[model samples]
Target: MSERTLLVIGAGGHGKAVAEAALLSGEWQRIAFADDRWPALCETFGWPVVSDVAGLAALEIQVAGAIAAVGNNAVREQWVEAIRAAGLPLITVVHPRACVSAAATIGEGSAIMALAMVGVDAAIGEGAIVNASATVDHDVSLGDFAHLGVGVHLAGGVVVGARAWLQAGCSAGYRVAVADGVICAPGTVLVVD
Candidate 1:
């Protein structure tokens, strides 16, 4: 059987992390990048920029899956939808060092970074990010396009709403519901009931 080709849909730092996760996953044979600003055949992140939307049709034959690595919640959502419309399966990338429970369900386009822990039955939504060393306890729910920055911790039963951003080192108590589109400051603590 041939190996799967994955397209990394950004050309930035997060995109590099996502590509590295894909590599760590060990399922993708070849990796390519696509960005709005890159030329059709330029090299970035040690990979080729196949093309943005304009070249998806031509590149589709070589790309079996894609992940939108954009860090911005709104742009990530848009890229997720665009990749769907183009009929490419969005890949969920979990780094090799991450500990994800078997009962956990991670949605497509999500990235579980290195050393992150996703506990039992945790539900991570599409395009969500669990950055390096973050902890998502059992029964936690991360909504679509939500981001948990590096070292953020969510106690069991925590619910992070759609497009919410928890900055680095933030921690939330159990049963907390972070509102949608909320931009939490770094190191913030929420003891919501």
Candidate 2:
């Protein structure tokens, strides 16, 4: 609605996906990528690669907000911090096709991709990622930088700790608690163990 521009850090696969989702959201008037590979990697998904990580300072006046589109949780957190320190607001990106309940809370710098379902009262922490086709049921709590890979499903009331990663096709049953920094393999199914 306003004259807002988004600077997405990271020009890799995850970054491209985030940028595409952001574009589909139609929330930003302009969007650009800033990666360490800037000059060598001039563009991604038809978007210009404007600057590198070190160049972020110069972009403070150019972009209204930013988001780290990195797949690595720890790296994303670091980029988010840098974006914050640069006085750029961290924005949440949700694809138009994603079914996110109005009661759900999506944190700053988080990205919810196409076909993802974020249920009522679900809490998505800062810099988190709900990748394509992921399903987070009601009352699920995802900590900061947590990543739910494509097709991953978390049943109701699941609590996933910070930096936890549930790889593709993984499924967790109701009320399951995943500790911080845990990395669940693809297709992994969690019971109430």
Q: In candidate 2, what are the lDDT values of residues 149-168, reduced to their tens digit?
A: 99999999999999999999
Model 1 per-residue lDDT at 171: 98
For each of the candidates, give the backbone clash count.
0, 0
lDDT (0-100) at residue 104 of candidate 2? 97
Best candidate according to TM-score: 2
Q: lDDT tens digits, residues 1-193, model 1? A: 8877789888789998888888877987678998887684477768888787545656745788889998899999988888888888888999999999999999988999999999999999989999999999999999999999999999999999999999999999989999999999999999965
lDDT of 2 at 42: 86
